[model samples]
Target: MRVAAFLCEALTRGTTHAEPLAVEGNRLDFVDTLRQLQPDLVINLCESLAADSRGEILIPGLLDLLGLPYTGSSALSLGLALHKPKAKELLRARGISTPAFAVVQRPEDVKAVDLPYPLIVKPAHEDASMGVDFDSVVHTPAELARAAIAVLSTFHQPALVEQFIQGREIYVPLLGNAPRRALPLTEIHFGQAFENRPNIVSYKAKWETESPECRDSTSALCRLEDTALEERLIQTAVGAFSALDCQDYGRVDLRVSAEGVPYVIDINPNCDLHPGAGFAKAAAAAGIDYPALANRLVEIALERTHGNPSHRTKGPGTARRVDPPNRNVLAGRGPVRHRAGGPRAHAE
Candidate 1:
């Protein structure tokens, strides 16, 4: 079936604009472009785009208006997942284990917060380790404040200060919904460099593909021997994914402590799905090849669309939809409210 791949110009910049590519320089045009193509399905790989432009909102709304099926989580899930603080708060309330964190909008905000040192600081809304690096680990309150200010000034957003979990970095890829399948567990091997720098996936390690410091710092390795441990990891990964209402496929990053206790570090809804990316690698380990995996996602989207009859329409209408409020507004003020029988007591 034909698929419309919607990606932001920020991601496509400096890249070749070849066929099968519809580049929307501004995210506002995403819906209009999708309307023009009217493909059978839409693969939303547009994480780098601005959230306020309602880039997240427009996707699902467009699909609903046009009665088209699409891959990945719905717009509500996308908005919740994009806001780190809100996601963490929701997860915490659900009793899903996550790193303890404090949101910092300004340098002075760090003063009242009470998280431990060697704290990790990052842009609250950014993913793919945008402002995270070795310097993100701060030991002193002053250093933490400085890092928070730097991230806010650079990314123009609030900073998330979280307790740094020191242990093995593990990633579990989850697919399907009714009976979610967690692929093989992938570990980040720091190797000898851990002696010098202590293993952590910094921003440079992720974005700078050719940086020697990163090259020497990290590696993704799978194939674990312990069946019981693997089972536990998979269960925890699935729990976290479901807790966040993530759909289709996604990856959950966790850190296992010395006692084998896993803490959810991050839940990625629209993770990198390139054939060479971690998600694909993990799927391959689970016996789902790249093309098969992609097709499976399409099938899942169609199933969801068919089940939700009210969500379908013949074509895009002129109905205008308003954007939802920023998640920060809710999370920044106080503790988030949860429905009854919240957070399940899962391992991670």
Candidate 2:
């Protein structure tokens, strides 16, 4: 099988995100390579091109145009997931317990917010914890205005001000299509250094391994004694995943309140898949190793395209010939705020 592991340059070597896709495959660092050496399947790890996350859907959009099957969510799903506010709106509409949020399209728009304070302000259309820090959690209107203004000026997008849910942070990873199941859940335990800081996962905690924020925030497989509560959390996660129309695999991040209610914080359809990431670790807990997980993604894509995954499991899978075409005009980010009675964005 000629499988191409599509990834960005920073994820090429010696990185946590690079190790999961070490399965037998060709390493494609550029879209041109994808055009020249067409493969049977693609394990898309390239979150973005040209260092802009807005370009995350460009490659997948191209593959879709060329009728090439790839792993994870589609271009439309990626674009929808990239916008935090819009995603939350859909979740709320589906009766999913998400924090109340207000979108600040401009700095002055902050005054229109009616949600309770101690809101977490972040860039409207970004992932990987971009533009999120301790200061993002504001308790006063003045602080909210300042944070929203900073996010607007920095990310050139609206600021999503969501109610800050303080509780146990949990992440649930889901896989497959017809019968999607939740992997072992992970709980983020903030250490002593986090005593004075908000418990939210910031960009520094995610991208900077050496930083105090990253070092102090730890993740462990959750252990629950209440079976009913555990069941509730699983149902919530699955409901949110289904609501988003996430395909192949995705992760749902939530915070368990003091009353044991789970609130959906974020739904990442194209989340990190490195061997050390929470998703892979959860898969490992279920006895599916990284190599097998990677291969399973390929098989899922093949199954969705051909209706049978059994044949693809054998080595050297047959490739459907596809002619290269002109690049797609990438789909940009959707509207920052959902208009009243306007169409909603769903999983593709």
Candidate 3:
């Protein structure tokens, strides 16, 4: 609700109108509505379709079919980022640093996992830490099997088991294209409540606000003690963003090892833009307030209409989908923002 309202406010900042257009199901209805409405632009905030995370990729694909210019990453990028193993592979292919990870389909599959014991287990296809919990971080073989099985059964997806980097967890928000600027870094702060707890941003830590995990963990602007590590963090984050083919705006999450090496933990395209989101906080740190950040995203998408991937993807007929003089209110799909970890299930 806040995501759509804020985006609408931002779109209307310059006389352009925007409105929330939630799709409660029925793809045909959604399609017919967009065609009839023929919106000049769409500020897409949806990370899923019909409550299914995998369906998020189809949202952009649907918008493209309607020939409407929408803000954020493309269908291909969203798909890659939503599937953990695929995104990690792309990062590795680009020579980017990501924690060693394996996909486990069953409890027995944990045996084939050659990674270290102090690893994190999570739903391979879930976002917003939907299936992640304090138990997700395991230190023993038994713990690993339990965690993997929990994710596999609960989320109905394979489990992603990976080495858990022990260090600072940082979030780098990227805005714009060609230059894809990285905003000031933000890190998750653990308070006294986390004293005896494992220092990890679990699902409860990110979403269950009333829970101790969430209360103990807070997101704040962070400056690395070592300036050099800061730069590497930014560079590696940008590399991950580019490797995932994210556009307009996104967030790259990382856990810097004690050795100061930054490992790409997750790449989120079309990241949450709520005023209180991590991406928004980083943007605010860089002097791009929520409203201006929203404005910039719309402008970035518009700027790409000339021979860019967006334009080419729109194809010839979709050219008419550009900002027409009769452009009505910019429609949007709301309630897709991740209010917890703050992503498109953002890694905390």
TM-score leader: 3
Error of 1 at 185 (Å): 1.1
Best by lDDT: 3
List ranges where model 3 is wrong by over 4 Å.
Answer: 307-326, 334-348
Please, what's the RMSD in Å of model 2?
Answer: 9.2
lDDT of 3 by residue, 245-288 (tens): 88988888899888889999888788777777778778888898
TM-score of every prediction relative to native: 0.78, 0.81, 0.90
C-alpha lDDT of all candidate models, in order? 0.64, 0.71, 0.78
What is candidate 3's local distance difference test score?
0.78
lDDT tens per residue, model 2, 17-97: 222221111223444544564555566665665556776777678778766677789887888788777778788889999
- Residue lDDT tens for model 1, 1-348: 012222221112232121233324443554565567555555555443333323554556556677656678877777777788998888888777788999998778988889766688888886666677778888898888889999989888899999988887888888877667777777776655445564677655665556544556444555667677677777777877887788988888888877777788888886666565677777777788866676567556655655522234424452322212220000000111111221111101
TM-score of 1: 0.78
Task: Write down the TM-score for model 2.
Answer: 0.81
Which structure is stronger by lDDT: 1 or 3? Answer: 3
- The lowest-lDDT stretch of 10 consecutive residues in candidate 2 is 339-348
